[model samples]
Target: MSTGFDREQGEFARGARAAVVYPDLGGSSRDADARLEETAGLALAIGIQVEDRLAFRLRQPKPGTLIGSGQVETLAEAVRDQELQLVVFDASLSAVQQRNLEGALGCKVIDRTGLILEIFGERARTAEGRLQVELAHLDYQAGRLVRSWTHLERQRGGFGFLGGPGETQIEADRRLIRDRMARLRKDLEQVSRTRSLHRERRQRAPWPVIALVGYTNAGKSTLFNRLTGSDVMAENLLFATLDPTLRQIALPGIDKAILSDTVGFVSELPTQLVAAFKATLEEVITADLLIHVRDVSHPDSEAQRDDVEAVLADIGVAETTPRIEAWNKIDLLDEERRAALSAETAQRDGVMAVSAATGQGIEALRTMMAQRLTAGHRRFVVRLDPSDGAGAAWLHQHGEVLDHWVEDDAAFYEIRMAAQDHDRFLARQDR
Candidate 1:
């Protein structure tokens, strides 16, 4: 038997042989380093095992290679030596740059957008999600109409006799993709309508909805699963949970309210992705409360927070929507930093620090959410006739009755409730 696998492996090797490259045009070296690491993480998520990385401090991007001629030659040699099957660029690349890089390196080249699209294509679970990913992919490939259609030379239809169609294979493929996109759009619209109807029904229920949103892999899903006792997919990978999962969280005081975990936002999330996944993100827009979770231990946590907020604003969730900020992943922080963060943000009403993984400060978060839910309630002390079962039933259904004392002639009650429900309570008592 052979001792170990050789570096020169088959094209269909189980592990990907990949490399990362970035053009250092501007920004701090620390930022560039972080981006390279993040890109490597993204590549790994897309089933690519990054074998090596190359960074060039180019003052400006070359139109063809993005890393200049000299750097391209060096990178090509490295790719040959390492036997890389694919190359990933940290920054977004134009169609020309992508084609040139692939030709020069003699391997498949992917930019940040393409890599992200590939991950989405692989991770999408629901029919709507799959359709959305396909739409994005078609839109992306449409722009790069280069060599992908070179295999349609001898294709024919029917019983394998001869060529049949007037249109080329490329044209026919484009038409088929367009038709599928049209059908997907119609289906997505129907899904949207159904979701709206479900939302309307939930409005009539006695629950306030709280949505958790943050950057990818920022522990939003973990917090969601912890709070709701759900077994939703929570992994260390990006976009682990694409479909929004809503679960009923029983807060201590307010026994039943919906807590929805929405898809994470990212910096420069493809515009096509936003357009296609609007159905999934509707949870964020319709939420009564938005919980913004941030990874406090991250070096760029504040910037990530701003990115999430920007996406929220774009989706119309930033206009007067009540939002609470959760400084998550506190378990990763040291004592000094934790104390510093706590002291800095302590006075803010909507800000709280917690660890989703270790279940730290979760009870306080639940209490805070309950307090927000009950903020508008007015304490009501009402005296009703003891035999009036109808009034008691109305109160029980419409509002939370704190306590009541049974008397011979009437019932003494203390209630904390919504103003609208309080009005209804008075009307039923009068009746």
Candidate 2:
């Protein structure tokens, strides 16, 4: 599960039995069992079967094993009795702790960061996605490489004791990793530049870009597909969508708007990933609006929402950016509870209750999106020269033309246009 521990290529074969362990340190906003359940889902996403799942209560962390000795012994017994090939810990582990835990447990061990990195590596489809994953994996591996090494002996080089091994194998490996990471970053910078160019062109195209963001497996892709009619892969698996997807859709009273379906955010997402995927997530950072599709029926929905908000804040998404909380998956709720939730959401200004699966409240959601996106528009009545086809076309493309007619060989248009577009139109008329 650890990225750098992939020396045995097929050691983590599909369907390998594994146990998930979550350290319940207490005072968490979310339940420990839910964390364990999420870890199991992540393991299953990569075809690993979770044979057992447990949350160990720990008031203090042990440097050697993270959990206490007795807890380690109990976990070891489970691994031995079940013949589990792997155990996943739903907490960040130090390199030393990971090494010692594996030694004590007598099996492969991975922590929350490593498990998430594994999922990102498995689900990354595009070349850019693959590169980002590799960069993050290298960053993680570089930190642990020294502690992961078995041989600490100096490789004798140059004249006897004078040189005393200029560089050890572990150091050499780390240098190589650093060099590879540099190259990947350079490549990603190029990708970022290309994406920037595309983004600039989209801005010039003058279409509003709306981004879909939420916790992993929170029905974002389903809502995106429902909105855009694009067949993006939407499954129940965690991290199902790694690459960002975009499609153009028409909204109520809006001709064209770009909708971006982004990779889902997860709790304790690897910081390495956040840094590496910043280029891709720039779309969300620059989005005109964000639609946070949440699994309202999930037990930890509020905590998950907070997790998503934290990631957005980490990525520097502006608090002023307009957001709509799409309380999704209401179909999973019982009728009475769903009704109460619907009523509550109706009273909230920026919230909507929706079931993307059943097509409920989707139209209302669209209307709300249109209203939010066009909230700054002002009505205008502009007259153009009879031969000014370009001016008429520009107005239609950039604004919602409510009515148009020709009288005295002049075309008059009544439109709802943004303040900036209205200014640009006046400038064009003066030109």
Candidate 3:
């Protein structure tokens, strides 16, 4: 969708002209500038034009406004000067703080969580993605529901919310929100079950699955398209690809592998979204291998990697899951720096420096993926009856046939396959 400007007129969209503010409490491992840059990127993702970006150093957060009144007045001056319609706070603002800040700043106020929910709300295209976003939004709004109605005293006579005999307007609204969220949860549960069934079927098959994971706008979709040759909305915007896309690709040694591109992670992603998107994230948790796509050109690439790791840990990715680094966007670097990195990474075991857009080092990356996925395969020997054409074909299709011979009117074959695949082959024989 076209954003931030009207098609008919060249006017800025309402609430699109804004400022991004970060409150530095001196607790975060990252400095203030990086946080502000990310927050501005979040704003720009949804077509918001950031007229001003500011970071304030606070000795302690105020209970009412999160920042000192002096700082609020200064921000208000900037807001009025810049003619901004919205103010985006980089920190999580409580309901009270948000209300007070709006009153003082003389403009609309949104915290980081609210802004992220807005991005997800707009970018979610699939039915399941919309459902998850709605659930997360409701979860966020439920806590901040205000009793601002002049007729809040009006209520029904019968029993209602909280098992009470009557319900206030706010309480009734909360009840409706809760009821909708409950229905969404049940629907999502069905989706999750279906996804689990699909994943189980893929596992029962011989093909391995690789999931691409990293921070938002880390060039994962580009890499996925480069690897699989499928166009799946690779854009420069954050959260460009909200829904997961899976495609079958052939590796050097493997006949087929399932490559999955998943939603990009962000720093301080809303907990509601994490809980809401559990079904979608199952792909990452269950993947046979994870390729972490990193934007090596970004100044905070290391910190971004840490944030991705934090989310992975929060989502319960197993320690046993094999992972490799794909240092992407090297083409953005100068020639000398890119060449040095390429030379440095070529000797590394689990790292590859490449540009997805330029197709540099892509073949080496493919080889590395195939080797990692097949590293744990076991060698096995099987004997089949002469009439068992299907069995022999299965062995050849699902495994690397090291040897084949005919002995005593039976077929003897030596192959390399994953343990689970071997078990499935044996199960077929028993059947």
Best by TM-score: 2
**Residues 1-431 of candidate 2: C-alpha lDDT, one tens digit per residue:** 23212333213345667899999988888888888889999888876789999889998999888899999999999999998878889999998998788788777787888778777876787889988987887787777763333122323211100112232334437777777788999999999999999999998878999999999999999999999888999998899999999999999888899999999999989999999999999999999999999999999999999999999999999999999999999999998999899789878898999999999999999999998999889999999997988988899888889998999988899999899989888998897
TM values, all candidates = 0.85, 0.91, 0.89
In candidate 1, position 279 carries an lDDT of 84
Task: Locate the minimum summed-lDDT window of 10 residues in model 3.
Answer: 156-165
- Candidate 2 has what TM-score? 0.91
Residue 413 local lDDT, model 2: 96
RMSD of 1: 6.5
lDDT by residue (tens digit), candidate 1, 1-431: 12112222202222558889877788643477777887898887766788887788988888887888989999999888998877888878888998798789887777888778767866777777776776676666666665443112322211111113331444426676577668878888998998898899987665788999999989999999889889899999888878788898777566578999877887778877888888888888988788899988888888888889889888777568777788999999999998998897787778889999999989999888877777788888888888878778667655668999987777988888888777766775566
Off by over 4 Å in 2: 1-10, 146-172, 405-409
Give lDDT for model 2: 0.85
lDDT of 3 by residue, 112-174 (tens): 988888788667878899889878877887777542311123232111111122324344378
For model 2 the local lDDT of residue 195 reads 98
Q: Each model's number of backbone clashes?
A: 0, 0, 0
Top candidate by lDDT: 2
